[model samples]
Target: MTVMTDRPHMTTEEFEDLARIAAQQAEGLRLEFIGGVLRSKAMPDGDHGRVILWLTRICMQHHPDFWLHPGQGIKAEQYREGRAIPDGVLAHEDAFVGQGDWVDPGPILMAVEVTSWDSDTERRDRIERPRAYAQTGIPVYLLIDRLKCQVLVHSDPDGNGYETVRTVPFGKEVKLPDPVGITLHTEPLKDWVR
Candidate 1:
């Protein structure tokens, strides 16, 4: 039932080159390479932006030194062969400083995705994201599932994937694990997901 297949369509270098050209041809078009497959990311809707804004505020309030950077390109999966543009990448303020377009995921504490209103949201956000982030050993992968009205916190990456996953419905409180020790009062999320 895994979303990612074993075979990749192209090498990381080819994918990166294609991504660059694609971005130039179509403004705001994002491409991701994961599980050896190519996937396109849709543009965010207002609600999606709002959700990220809310999380950014909370992250800054609790950890001023940390940041929830939106649409940050990250090197992912084994041998840094995969690349993904996570909706939000949580890391220290200068984690990506002076880095190229796709930065290393080592300093990233968490990767967040707010479900989009699209056919690919389910596989892209719920399945591909966690697996990619976990395989890169990211400490956490937080998914704010708009359609499901729930938040899934994935942590404890055991290489292949995360070992622990905790889901909390909207309006309930959920604590993100260490490296990102922030307790979120998710009631406001109810407002944003609409």
Candidate 2:
């Protein structure tokens, strides 16, 4: 929480280096490249991690065609434009399965910041990142904002963005039938132990 430098953004290479260093050092921190910036986010709680895990698992059951890749420091491209890491992402075999990389062939689905307190950048991810991903012709963008304990689903991809299909909260029945057919009972998300 005590950084001396005023870093608004850094290149993909710099971000990768920092990420590697953070992993190697036992500083016990979490990080990601958000808004072209290198940031060390606060420690995530049980709720944050489990929600993503559950989302990845159940989503795959609903749509076996797409693979829900783990948030394992893999590089993702924004329609062959910008590069950043996602909390959780989906890789489709038809388009980008055996390709160069997400940045090279592009990923058709991605998730942005879902567990942070930086309000400004968080909103930017919910707003800007989705727009960028949609422009890449990606079909879905899910913003997991626990701030209000809600999962905002955007689909029906248009130019440079997706429509706000619905905001599913705890105890709500959520549905996404376009790129995938998933009806999730999200009350467990609100009960996040983290």
Candidate 3:
């Protein structure tokens, strides 16, 4: 569950400005505004990048018209007050054409998150992302949890959260339901995670 506070740390606009400046800095830090809180996202490890690349290849092969855009910012939450840069935002090739840094969630087919080997991965990836994406009515949320060594496919968004959640251990073949019609042979994922 998302921990809501009495007030937000900063407005979405403020977070956006800070995130942009931070991106240009040497550290290349990425920030996310979720559940009325500002959180810094951890940089992905080598294996993390491989996991994303693996998914990207499969998504493109299955649906050539769709693209898995990495580090794409999205306007999230029920009221669109939150900003989250999902690990990969699956959408049509030209879905975000002419959009600003943050794009609306309407055209997003799926939001993918490959867990980072960070202390906060549990709450940020497992808890917060699903809520924010579901509230935004995102059709699917695919969580490749490295720590747990499982792949969770979240679908059937109902504003509160995803109504149907399917979890499959790595090495299993899991089907990502419609809007994102594809089957993942997660055997390769086994090699990517620790």
Best-performing candidate as measured by TM-score: 3
lDDT value, residue 96 of candidate 2: 44
Clashes of 3: 0
lDDT, residue 186, model 2: 74
Give RMSD (Å) of candidate 2 vs. truth.
4.7
Instruction: Return the candidate ranking by TM-score, descending.
Output: 3, 1, 2
What are the runs in model 3 whose C-alpha is more than 4 Å off? 1-4
- Residues 1-194 of candidate 3 have per-residue lDDT tens digits of 77558889888889899888988894868888999898888888999999999999999999899999999999999799999999999999999999988998899999999998889988988899999999999999999998999999999999989999999999999999998989999988889877
A best-first ranking of the candidates according to their lDDT comes to 3, 1, 2
**Poorest stretch of ten by lDDT in candidate 3:** 1-10
TM-scores of the candidates in the order shown: 0.95, 0.70, 0.95
Evaluation by TM-score, superior candidate among 2 and 3: 3
lDDT of 3 at 17: 91
Where in model 2 is the C-alpha error above 4 Å?
Answer: 1-36, 41-43, 72-81, 92-107, 110-113, 117-121
By TM-score, the better pick of 1 and 2 is 1
Q: What would the per-residue lDDT of candidate 2 be over residues 1-194, giving only the tens digit for each residue?
A: 77534544666666666766776895756566644555555555666677777887886786677766654344433524345556667766454445432344254454434655655556566765676556556666777777778877777667657765578776787776565666778787767733
